[model samples]
Target: MAGKDRQITLRFLAEPADVNFGGKVHGGAVMKWIDLAAYACAAGWSGKYSITVYAGGIRFVEPIHVGNLVEVGAKVIYTGRTSMHIGIDVRAGDPKNAERHLTTHCIVIMVAVDDEGQPTQVPEWVPVTEADIKLRDSALRLMEMRKKIGAEMAAHVTPGG
Candidate 1:
């Protein structure tokens, strides 16, 4: 699949404050970067102000450490009438060892809004590459997975008598 039109990259240096006692980077910090990067990508795609309505399926595969350089990549993956799905990938690098790592992945949903702060439909996106296809498929898969999980949870939640 081809990449999105406006891919954005954000890089930051991990500090002691950004990591946990175990030397692993804090999940909260990663989450914050994810949201920020996703916001930028979504806004770039929509060309309008947007607000995050949902952030789902943030999975951390590896722990990052202080002194590592964290790189965040953001892209617009899907679009609805007024909402867009943004995908973020986090990687880390240890300059001393010349090693790079993948730490986390996440997706966030944001909606475009009008000047009055009401939800507004976005213009049609022009997807021109295979990466866009991959992004679209990934978003659809996550959405379906969330829906199935929600249905199962609802089925198991017995109403109080």
Candidate 2:
């Protein structure tokens, strides 16, 4: 699919209800937004209902204030037989002005699913631009790191303890 067709952006205002005790938007709220954006991008690219299988490297770089204009952008960076790696960026700024700063970033792995909830194949995503190529490479590196981290954790942790 073309790059433009494999991306989605959601923009909205951060509300007071989204604020945490620290006077900024709650981390959970931000994460929910990220998941929603990633789902939209993955489903759009795959043309099937997509479910988040994994989300990692979620960095809360800066606080998002109430009333700030929040933007969540998600793009398909890589594709496997059934999964799509979505890169998500969250930015926020004063709604009155045009400036926005990156507030969070993460990588989400979404798998397309059939009506029965079984994993379904998705259309392959090809990198066409320099940015796309770089993002795809980054996703590949993250996948490798995830494997190593998972192995290390499994070795040290017990199922019930």
Candidate 3:
């Protein structure tokens, strides 16, 4: 499982059902795949069910056409006492040629949960490989940006009487 592995790659074909009116894969459909991939990655590392607390920085770089080979790469970039920040990149291309282009990318935060559905602690992630270290550093930068954004939102949110 991911809890022990910490990274996973999901590959499949883009079906026609995932296409939009413009004949390209729908954005919502792609997001669903991203969420599922992230969930799998988090659950693997946490050794328990996990819930997505946040999904951000989704960038759709190119349109995914029906019949293209799709690959969703997910990795646990950072972990907290009870949370894991997963980074995902979606790429699609010709399966026969084996060349893939980045179609979308995003970051998702998943929180491990116990049987009672409450948050639980996840094993810490220590970077070993150079790629892992680079991703961890990027995750740290994003975390800081998230904190700043949260603070700004909290200051503007009106309290209920």
Candidate 4:
């Protein structure tokens, strides 16, 4: 992986087909963009294929309107043996306007994969900037909360329930 490959960005216009019946962009469409951006960042950093294992705290803070210029930014904030923790920000605004407002944010975990599609080791990432350090620490702090939520969700799901 190149030194500067840890971050990836994508920008495009939110099309009419991406909207919900209410005329706002669908959350699913945003999530799809997020996933794509995450994959690109993870793959670039790992120098191999990567798959999303988990996406946490997807916050849809604002509704996006069609024709808005949507931008998705993905960066690897932390890394484990085979997983890269990516933070994604989705922003949008009028194409004619330069200013963009954040619409959503999320944290996604992607695992590097081998030819057999099994988890593979990825190059470790070390924090360089202050922002990277803070984001990495934030990811560490979320582990306990994630475990609790996972356990609670698991308990709610019985064999067929």
Using TM-score, give the best candidate's number: 4
Tens-place lDDT per residue, model 2, 1-161, is 52247888999999999999999999999999999999999988988899999999999999999999999999899999999999999999999999999999999999999999999999899898999999999999999999999988888887788
Model 3 accuracy (lDDT, Cα): 0.94
lDDT of each: 0.82, 0.94, 0.94, 0.92
The reply for model 2, stretches above 4 Å from the true place, is 1-4
Which tens-of-lDDT digit does each residue in 1-161 have in candidate 4? 43368898899999999989999999999999999999999989999899999998999999999999999999988999999999999999999989999999999999999999999998888998898899999998887789988898997787965
Tell me each candidate's TM-score.
Answer: 0.82, 0.95, 0.92, 0.95
List, residue by residue over 1-161, the lDDT tens digit for candidate 1: 11234668988788888877677888998999988888788777778888998887788999888888888998777888898888888999885665667889888888989899999887555566897887788788888998889888898888993
Model 3, residue 105: distance off in Å is 0.9
Candidate 3's error at 144, in angstroms? 1.2
Q: Flag regions of model 4 displaced more than 4 Å.
A: none
Give the count of colliding residue pairs in each prediction.
6, 0, 4, 0
In Å, residue 127's CA in model 1 sits off its true spot by 3.1
Candidates sorted on TM-score, descending? 4, 2, 3, 1
